[model samples]
Target: MDKCKVDVAIIGAGTAGMGAYRAARAHTENVVMIEGGPFGTTCARVGCMPSKLLIAAAEAAHDMKHAELFGVYPGDVRIDGKAVMERVRRERDRFVGFVLEAVESFPEKHRLKGHARFLDAHRLQVAENCEVEAGRIIIATGSRPNIPQMLKAAGDRLIVNDDVFSFDDLPDSVAVFGPGVIGLELGQALSRLGVRVRMFGASGGLGAIRDEKIRDYALQVFNEEFPLDPAASVSSVERTEEGVAVTFEDGDRGTVTETFEYLLAATGRRPNVDDLDLQNSDLELDDRGLPLFDRYTLQCGSSHIFMTGDANNDLPLLHEAADEGRIAGENAGRYPEVRAGSRRAPLAIVFTDPQIAVVGMNIQQAHDHCGGCFEVGEVSFEGQGRSRVLGKNKGLLRVYGERGSGLFLGAEMFGPAAEHLAHLLAWSVQNRMTVPDMLGMPYYHPVIEEGLRSALRDLNRRLLMGPESVERCLDCGPGA
Candidate 1:
């Protein structure tokens, strides 16, 4: 095959790969992006974008079922799973079409539609018998659902988040085998869609939030809202006449079996590193199968090659992936003398019902390091007017700061528009804003924006009264 030369060759056309392509093109003219499978990503086809649409449909169905609570009784609500699935497919198709069109229009950017394998340190072989040798390369292959091997006995009955919504009909019951973001979101979404879902995880938690108290409250709310069995762990899965029989080791010497129409193996996700045949290249791999890169520079052993997105073993959210790709591409194109000056830290958002957003250190983290100077505050969603009006009033906003100095170290929230709130917190943490600086920002009234102000008030009070002061107040307090 004839060797094709380029300034940059990015493997994987997902969010990170596309981001690198866009960012690299701004600096250099010769860029090529190779993607295996379809041109679009799970985010466009089935991941975040499509799954959220399905969840919204389920929410609508759930609301209709309990419409009598609002005094406007709208009769019995019936959901046609077929219609719902059709709508979901339509939405996914529409978004996928946009991505396909975008990629097709980039005539200057060579988009190869096949698997990419490393032929050498700087050369890659594409399935189309084409070879690409670039000055710099970026691997942003992203990740896939990490289903547990224990569920493999059920074979066809088992599905992961990547293909969960592709079922011809809604399952009568489902057993989700994890407590991470994907598991929790799918379990909740399916439960809302009228499936009897029982979720199980290694940790007795709802998601990966740092605060144990908040985790407990989240699990409690999830259990109350849906059928959750945090204690259950699947020993094996066997097919039954109805569906799949999931056997769980209940205790030291006992096992319990439950039959479900489907088994969603929502364990977790791992980077898409193995498929790339990195052995042919000089890239190093961490124990978790992620690309080993400098924590700050995101550069592989050779600065000419970089890894971004989930492949980098850092933050795996879409926003963080984009940022990493931008940084990697910019640095790759910049003169070596100037590349060392850039600074960046990642922030992430897990898009569950009550979205989990995080930036910088938690209060405990700050306390462990800068003990006496730490001031923290928590405000509940029950006090937010927008939350009450939206009827999603079950979350809290927490902030950590330095005493008297007011410098914000971190913030977290599990509530409506949490991702949006994370942006504000990220800005504050990145700039090392003081408590007064954050509180001074005038938030609009009667909107979700008030949650930030309410949270800031709690931090202000905590700072005024000192760390030993009671964290909670009633009646006149912001939390109240």
Candidate 2:
């Protein structure tokens, strides 16, 4: 067997792996990256980029259909599924090409083209032929969609994100299982594109927003776009001559069997660590078989091994994976004097019609951490000027803050321009800004930002800040 040694060995060429590779290379040129196939990162190839392409197309179709609201009626409207998929694939390939080029830029010998398994703490066996010895290792193998074994019986009728973008044509109808981020996004997009879509979630929430009010608002908005059953408990899935049959029980509706041309299993994802032969190492495994690693340092129990990205199963978003990868790579290269890394405040967004955003702590987290110490402020978009003008005057925004110090805690909202609002809130939370500080900032008239100001004003009213202090601040000079 061939033998090789490197300063750092990164397994998986996805976003996290690539992030680690770039960082490790800064410390030493003797860095290598290994992957089996499908060189593009997951976000560009399947998760974020391709999904957004479909969503954008669906949004365009929806806008054209709704143009009548503005007294502008364009004649007949038709959608060609084949053309839409082709555009998505064409644009997606461009993004993937960039990643492929970056990977190929590395020396051919440094780019191992095969699966790698752990032989020992500091050793790896690649594809049964080559062996690699590295001073430190970064495992950023990313993740794969987790489909239940029961659904495998459907054969080609079942689809996951990995293969959904490659379809030659759209299905006539689809029943999406698990109304998480992927399920809701695709389900609504397909519905807008004229495909009959139904979504089911075992839990009582849509996407990852746990705030009850925000979830209810999301349900209301999503219900208008497509059928959603959050209380559904899937019982069975079977193949049919024409398509696939699904049996499920809903709290509102009794046991029902529905047939759809295709089934999408967005049931979540599992870290790609099972095939890495982690058992051969001394690192302790969790109940889910993930390595026990420090969140701040991204280092596993073994000093020579580090875990990052989706492989750690902390936050599976692409941006989070990239940040974790940088942390892991930096610490791995700086071994004995490991440095801690600070992560950004929690920020998650679901790109549905009105959009769903959860910045920092949600209601449940705030309640659990602060109990009654936190005050909630809210505003409904029903009467908001900008929202009504744009025909998006439906949904709600809720902001949470400490009652005494008025420190911004977190926020969850379902409203127009929610993505922007979520980022503003996340940035404020990261900087530990207080409610008064936010209110002191300028809020443009007839803009969605006014909704945030209204919520903050409500919070300020409930805060313990004295009236004198409030007045003093209100009358203070601009520089003060």
Candidate 3:
């Protein structure tokens, strides 16, 4: 068997693996990246980019339908499934092309093709032909869509988020399981695009929201558009020539049997570590069977093996994966002198209408992280002036802060412009800015941001810190 040695070796050339390769090259020239699958990232190929394309199409259709609320009537809206899928696939391929260009630019000598599994702490077997021995190894194989075995009963009728973008034409109806990020975003988008959708979640959760108030508000809004059962009582699933048959209780409608052209399983994702034979790596595994590692340093135990990105399963967002990959690579390049790398504040956004954002600590984590010395302040956008003016007045925003320190810790919001709002909150939390400090920032009147200021003012009052909100936003603010 052919064998090779390198200062550093990285497995899987997805977003995180690629980031690790670039970072490691800064410290050592003897680096190699092994990838068994396609070069494009999950985001470019299946996760973010393609999904957003579909959502964009849905948004256009939805806006035209709702324009009457503004006293401007648009005629009957008809969806072109073929054209929508074509654009989604075309644009998706374009984004994937960009990533491919980046990968192909690397010298051939630095790239290895084949799946790799651990032979030992310092060695790897690649596709049965070659073996790699390295001073340090970084695992960034990423993850795949996870489906429960029961869902497999749908057989050929079952699909996942990765399969959604590949449809040549939209299905007539779909039964979506899991109301998490993938299910909620795609389910809502599909519904808006004229597909009959029924979403069922075994867990009583919606999007990434943990706060009951925000989650319930989103749940109500979504159900108004499509049928959603956050806590479903599903009894059986079977497949037939037509599609999949699902039997479940539909609340007021009681038990109902529905047949859908497709059943989408968006339950969650599992790491790619299973095939790597981690048992041979001599690294301690966590309860999830992933290698135990330092969250800050990305080192697995005290060994030369390091894991990051979805492989570590800490936070699977694309940006988090990239950050962890760079940190792991930097530590691997330096070995014994490993140092912890800086990480950005936690932030998650779900792109459903009214959006959903969770920044820094969520409601579930506030007490644990803030020592139970936190308070919450909120505002309902139903009466917010900008929202009413835009005819998008609905949803809520809840901000959390420390009692005495009055620091802006985190927030969970389901409201208009939540994606933008979350970014500002994330920046503030990373800076450790207190609520009083945030209240001093500028607020342009008649904008959606005034809603944020109102919430901060309420938070300041509750905290008994920070100056009273500058008497502002009357002209174009809530109740204006």
Write the residue-wise lDDT of candidate 3 on 154-210 in tens digits. Answer: 999999999999999998999999999999899999999999999999979788899
TM per candidate: 0.89, 0.95, 0.98
- How many residue pairs clash (N, CA or C atoms closer than 3 angstroms) in each of the candidate models, in the order given? 4, 0, 1
Candidate 2, 214-256: lDDT as tens digits: 8887887788878798877789989999799989886667888
Better of 1 and 3 by TM-score: 3
Clashes of 2: 0
lDDT of 1 by residue, 19-136 (tens): 8888888888788888887888768876888788778887788778766666767787877888888788888889999998888888744777678888888889888578899888
Error of 2 at 420 (Å): 0.9
Report how far residue 35 has shifted in candidate 1, in Å.
1.5
- The best candidate by lDDT is 3
Error of 2 at 242 (Å): 1.5
- Enumerate residue pairs that collide in model 1: 42-47, 373-403, 406-434, 406-435
Q: Where's the lowest-lDDT run of ten residues in candidate 2? A: 471-480
| Model 1 collision count | 4
